[model samples]
Target chain A: MKHYNIYVTSKPVIYDPAGRASENTLAKLGFSGIERLRIGKFIEMQCADDVSLESIKQMCDQLLANPVLEDFRIEIVD
Target chain B: MSDFRFGIVVFPGTNCEQDVAHAVRWLGHQAEYIWHQDTTVSQFDALVLPGGSSYGNYLRPGALAAASPIIAAISEYAAQGKPVLGISNGFQILTEAGLLPGALQQNASLTHICETLDFYVEKTVCQWLQLASGTMISLPVSHGFGSYYADAATLIQMESNGQIVLRDTQARIAAVCNEQGNVFGMMPHPERACEVLAANHPAGAGGTVFSTIVKHLEVVR
Candidate 1:
C-alpha cells in the first residue's frame, strides 16, 4: 500500500466566515492588529501502491474535494 | 372546508415534523403525519420529508430511510409532479431515493456544520423559489454531511437546465431541484427559523419557504 499526504486549502479569495466571525469577536475583546486568517484541512489516506499518482489526483478532484472553493496538494511519503 | 391536503413523512429519528406541519397549516393548508412504514401516499397535495437521522444514521445519513415504505410511495408521487421538499437529512433521503440526483458527503473540513448559511435564489422557474434571481435568505444549517457531489456531466446539466436552485454568494450551491424542478432537496433548515410563531417571527423568518410553496399550489389549484 502507498501512503499519501494531502493538504487542502481554501481559495485565497474565498471568505472564511467562521474565521471572520472569530476575528470580529477577538477585536471586540481588545485583541487588535490581527491581520489575515485562513483555514484549511489536512487529510491522510492510504492507497494501493499500484494506484498511480494521476488516478489519486482525479479522486481528489472529483470525490475528495470541491475544486471551485478548495485546492489540494498531494505528496507521497515513504 | 377541505383546503389543500399535505403530508409530512415521519421516519424513526426525524424531529422537524411540527415545524413543517406548522408551515403547511399556517398557509391555509392541511398537513398529516405519515409514518415511514406505510407505503401509501396519503391523500395529499404535497409531501414533505423533514430533517433528522433515520434508522440511527447507519450506512449513510438517509440510506435506510430512503428504502422505507413511505419513501416508495413518495417516489411514485414525485413522478407525477407532486411537490416533494426534502430539508437537510430529508435532502439526503431524496438523493438516496433517487428522486434527486447527486450525493452529499461530509463537509470540506470534515466537521459538523451548525450555523446560519445564506442561500440565494438561482432559478426563478422553480415553484418553491419564485423569488427574483439573487434574492438572499438566511437559514440554519446543521449537519455533518451536506457537501454535494455529482459527475461532471450531471453538474453541467444541472446548471444548464436550471436545476441548481439555491447557491451562496460565493456560488457554492446550497440547494438543488430535481429535473422536474418540483422536487427540491436542500441542506439548510428553513423551518428552524423562529418565524414559525407570530411572537418569535423575526427570528424565525424562514416561513417564506412554506409561503412560497403555498403560493405555487394556489396558482395551480
Candidate 2:
C-alpha cells in the first residue's frame, strides 16, 4: 500500500471568508506579523501500489475538490 | 394534460424535502420524494433538490452529494431542458455537480445567517421565476456558505444570457439559472415562505415558483 496526501484550497481569486475571520481573530489576540492566511483541507489516504497518478488526479477532479472555486494537489508520500 | 409531477431529490441529512413537497402540493401539483440512490428520474416532469447538510456536508457543502448516483439522473433530466430547482444546500450541490456555473462560498460575515430577506428579481428567464423583473420578494435564507462566486467570464456570460435571476438587497447574487434557463439554484428557502399562516405573509412567493414550473411544463408538454 502507498500513502498519498491531498491538499485542497479555494482558488486565489475566490474570497475565503472563514480564513479572513480567523485572521481577524488572530489579530485581536496580538498575533501580528502574519501577512495573510488562507484556509484549506488536507486528506491522507492509502491506495494500492497499482493505483496510477492519473487515477488520483481523476479522483481530485471528480470528488476531492471542486475545480470551479477550489484547486487540489496530490502527493505520493510512500 | 395530466397534473405536473415533481420529484424532490432527497440526500442523506436533507431536512427540507418535506417542505419542498408541501410547497409543491400547495401549488396543486403532485410531489414525490426521490432517494439519493435512485438511478432514474425520467418519470417526473420536474425535479427539486431540497436544502440540508447532505452527506453531512463533509469536505465541502454539497460536494459528496453531488457525486451521488441520483445526480447523474438529475443531470440527464436537466439536459432535456426540464425545470430543476435547487434551494440553499441544493444550490451548492448543483454547482458542485456542474449543473450550474459558479460556486457557493462561505458568507462574508462568516456566520450562519437565518433570516427572512428580500430578494430583488433581476431576471425572469428561469422557469421557476414568474414575478416581474425588479420585484422584491421575501424569502428566508439560512446558510453559512451561501456566498456566490464565479469566474469573471462566467459571470459576464451569465449576466448577458439573463441567467442571473435574483439578488439580495446588497446586490449579491441569491439565485441564478443555467444558460438554458431550465436549471435554477438559489440560496433562499422559498419553501419556508409558501404558507399563509401569518398575516404579513410573503404571500407564498415561493409557491408562485412552483406554479411557474407547472406552467412551463404545460407549455412544453
Best by DockQ: 2
- A6-62: candidate 1 lDDT, tens digit per residue: 887766755565567777888999999999766667789897889999998987775
Clashing pairs in 2: none
Please provide TM-scores, in order, for all candidate models, with all chains considered together. Answer: 0.70, 0.95
lDDT per residue as tens, model 1, B146-212: 8887767889998888888888767877788887778989888877773535332345347677777
**Residue B97 lDDT, candidate 1, scale 0-100:** 75
Q: Looking at candidate 1, what is the lDDT of residue B138?
A: 77
Model 2 ranges off by over 4 Å: B198-201
Cα lDDT tens digits, model 2, A30-77, are: 999988899999999898999988999999998888888889988889
Model 2, span B105-165: residue lDDT tens: 8888888998888889886578888544778888888999999999899899899999999
Q: Each candidate's interface RMSD, rounded to one decimal?
A: 8.3, 0.9
Off by over 4 Å in 1: A1-78, B194-205
C-alpha lDDT of all candidate models, in order: 0.78, 0.88
Q: Which ten contiguous residues of candidate 1 chain B have the minimum total lDDT?
A: B196-205
lDDT of 2 at B199: 34
lDDT of 2: 0.88
